[model samples]
Target: MTKALKASGFLGLATMMAVGLHQFVILSGGNPVPPWMIGGHAHLGVLSILAIVMGFAVPALGVTGQLRTAVTVLYIAGQWGIPGIVWLGEGFGLTFLMPTGFLWGLALIASMLIMFYVTITGDGDAGDRGPTATAPADD
Candidate 1:
């Protein structure tokens, strides 16, 4: 979990750098930047921070292995892959990756679902019971 959090934080820093680079490109060029590039850059910058926070929170969520893996993959895609695809597409003026937008959307949705489930279910502590429930005491 600690490693995951560190990884997320590093990604967030990288995303911030990307955003700065995007701004530099726009400001340095007389030509206008594309709206998709701007939007993608902004979203990635914000979502990267969210990913880091989520990474820190997820360990307490007690998610199953499969669900944890899903969350990690989807979060990474949302935080990194979407913006990267946009950067490449815009840089090369290629539309081949446009269809991947759907995948990015799915990744966002999956991450949200995992968070919602964890929040609602008390961090996946299945063995935990309320005050009215008690475990047997060892003598």
Candidate 2:
């Protein structure tokens, strides 16, 4: 979980860099962004950062096993898939990619809801607060 979270953070950083690259592409071409593309780019950038933050929290939040796996898959797919779809659609002229982005968007929301549940309920190894923290008495 820890490793996965950290990797997600790095991926987020990469996404951020890509966002800047996107801006450069526009500027270099001197092309004004169409209204549709603006929202897709903005959402992709923000969600990428959110994924980075969530990656850190996943370990601290202590969600494990299947729940962790499910959330991770859904979150990663949605978070990464949107930008990918947009890139394919806009950059490669794949009009079919737009609908797939919406599906990924749904996955993103599902993952977020699961994350919220884990956070609010505080499930899993509640006592495992790193090496320094003492375990509670079984009695």
Candidate 3:
């Protein structure tokens, strides 16, 4: 899962860079930036960074096995799907794709909720922080 997340992160970064350069070219040509391009560029860059961070944090959060697999898949799908759909829908003026993109975003949010639940409930011992340092010492 970690490798998958990191691979996705790097891939996303590469893709985002290409988009960014495309945006630069558009601006350099004195053409107004398309709204879809701006949206795609921002989402791709931010989500790519989140993917990299989640790669490290997931393990520390003790998410493992099948559940981890599910989360990873959902995260990757949302990370790319949302913006990709935006590019398709807005760039090509096919607004029908917006609902599908919204679904993708919801999936991403669901995965986040699962992570939050796991963290608060302490579902695994992998990330046990042990006793709090602020606890009063025995007399």
Candidate 4:
């Protein structure tokens, strides 16, 4: 799962670079930046970073087997799906694609809630102190 997340992160970064270059070209040609490009760039950059960070944090969450796999897959899908849908819907005038993107958004939200529930409920290895933080020593 860690490797998959890392791989997706790198792939997303690469895609972002291409989008950036495209934007630069458009701007250099004296045209206004399209709203879709801006939206795509923001989603791609932010979600890519989250995916990479979550790669490390997942193991600490104590979720295992199918639950872990489901979360990972859903997150990665949203990381790519949101931006891809934006490009398709707004960039190419495929308005129908826009609504489908909400499905991906829901997937991301679901994954986040699951992890949050696990962490707060002490159901995972994170324990009371949470994943990376340590409790203060007694006086």
Residue clash pairs of candidate 4: none
Per-candidate TM equals 0.70, 0.72, 0.86, 0.85
- Model 1: residues with Cα > 4 Å off, grouped in runs: 25-34, 123-139
Error of 4 at 78 (Å): 0.8
Q: Model 2, range 112-134, lDDT digits (tens) per residue?
A: 88878987888566535686357
The weakest ten consecutive residues by lDDT in model 1 span 123-132
Which stretches of model 2 miss by more than 4 angstroms? 33-40, 123-139
What do the candidate models score in CA lDDT, each in turn?
A: 0.71, 0.74, 0.86, 0.86
What's model 1's overall lDDT? 0.71
The collision pairs in model 1 are none
TM-score sort, best first: 3, 4, 2, 1
* Tens digits of lDDT, candidate 3, 18-52: 98898899999999999889999899889989999
Instruction: Let me know the TM-score candidate 4 reaches against the reference structure.
Output: 0.85
